[model samples]
Target: MTLDLVNYEQKAHEAVKSFWSNREVAKQKQLLTGKADHGERAGVTAGKNMDGFLALVLDIIQANGLAHAEIHQNRSMLTLPGYFRPTKLWDLLVIYKGELIAAIELKSQVGSFGNNFNNRTEEAIGTAYDLWTAYREEAFGKQPRPFVGWLMMVEDAPKSRCAVRDASPHFPVFGEFEGASYLMRYDLLCQKLVKEQLYTTAALITSTRCAAETGEFSEMSSMTGFRPFVTALAGHVAAAAARLD
Candidate 1:
């Protein structure tokens, strides 16, 4: 890797380490090592962590060829509605070609495999409603907006990988989980939400990927290898977003 990669990872680590430090989630989880509960909150926090990690990823993705957000990019993070609004607010907004092409919500499983998953299912579905409601009201109408959704998670190599199932109908129940893959399990979630006409657009994205520290290249980074990967990924995303025009 280049010196720039090293620098980005270093900065990324600091950012992730400081994540839960936000007053809103300070009590949710401990910084550094991370908090407990291990299910949906972990996913939620991981999503939040991705927000930090993206700083590095977005930088790299821009260099490559992918749409992404930037540090100085014209963007804003706000409360979703009530306490729920801010807590469940969309993570990143990508502006491309003078239009709104996407909205992302990052989530990862930090041992939150059981109960926490259920909670996140609720939050995600609920937040989707909030997003759509906000969207039509000109939340992202500064230009043509594409209704997009992203649900990402960093899961531990589980002892058992469960089969995928579409599980949003059973909301507040099986919606959070059908087996192991929460994101995919809720694969039909976007469709269901759309069917309800909850939102005005149909560009949806939901993916589940795992992360581990294999080639940490350094003792400090032994816990995870996402720092480098995401750093390299940032540039690609940025370049893509810039190209949307």
Candidate 2:
């Protein structure tokens, strides 16, 4: 059978809840048990949970005719007088639909969604800023047209305090507010997506790893980003990520 998100969620929830429900287990353990580990995956990083999302991105790249999910590429060809390092980088680069597009760093959410927004905002800008090197080079030499793109994965959350969607709608809308107006000109491809409207397809998944017979809490569903046309869009994203060298 396919992976059941509900079951995984419940398991994580119960693991977290057990901190309070089973005080004995909390008190008994020494090195591994503490308030620090009170919640389910309380210490897991955002990148840790984004593997699946990244996989989807990889699939999007390939389906649309791009290349592999290469990482940590060095592009610092020139050195500045007194500025940031010469070597620059983009997370994943591939020629999408025949154009060399760079799928920059991915930003994810963890802890309080609002706080997560701050972190991701910085990450998004940093991801884009790497292009400054090429821009400077262009000023001196033949301009190299590099198509950059950003893929964000908003992880699921429940706690109101940690829930980013609850903190501000703009948290999830970072791409619109920040990426849309970064450079002299916006990406025509992305603009086309927005004007034409784009989307991705995903199965509605929920996890339920609660107490076996204790009967506890659960539920979440969103179709806002899903549309019939999304299948085509997702395929494009996938193919784009796959075609690059």
**All candidates' lDDT scores?**
0.43, 0.36
| lDDT for 9 (candidate 1) | 45
lDDT of 1 by residue, 1-245 (tens): 22234366465445444443332253354444455534334434333445554565444444444433332223344233332254344565554444554455555444444546567667767777676666667655545444344433334334213554444665555434455354344334444544565433222221223112221212112112344234323433443454563
RMSD of each: 9.8, 11.5
lDDT of model 2, residue 235:
47
lDDT of 2 by residue, 1-245 (tens): 12112233334334334422333333344225444443433434212343433444444444444434332234442221212445444454543333434333433333354445545455545434545444455522442344444533233334422312223555464443432321101122233333432212222222223332342432222331212122443444444444433
Name the regions of candidate 1 deviating beyond 4 angstroms.
1-48, 51-53, 60-88, 95-101, 154-211, 215-245
Q: Number of the top candidate by lDDT? A: 1
Q: After superposition, how far is residue 128 of candidate 2 from its true place, in Å?
A: 0.9
Where is model 2 more than 4 Å wrong at Cα? 1-42, 67-84, 88-90, 95-100, 132-144, 155-245
Q: Residue 75 lDDT in model 2?
A: 42
Give model 1's TM-score versus the native structure: 0.45
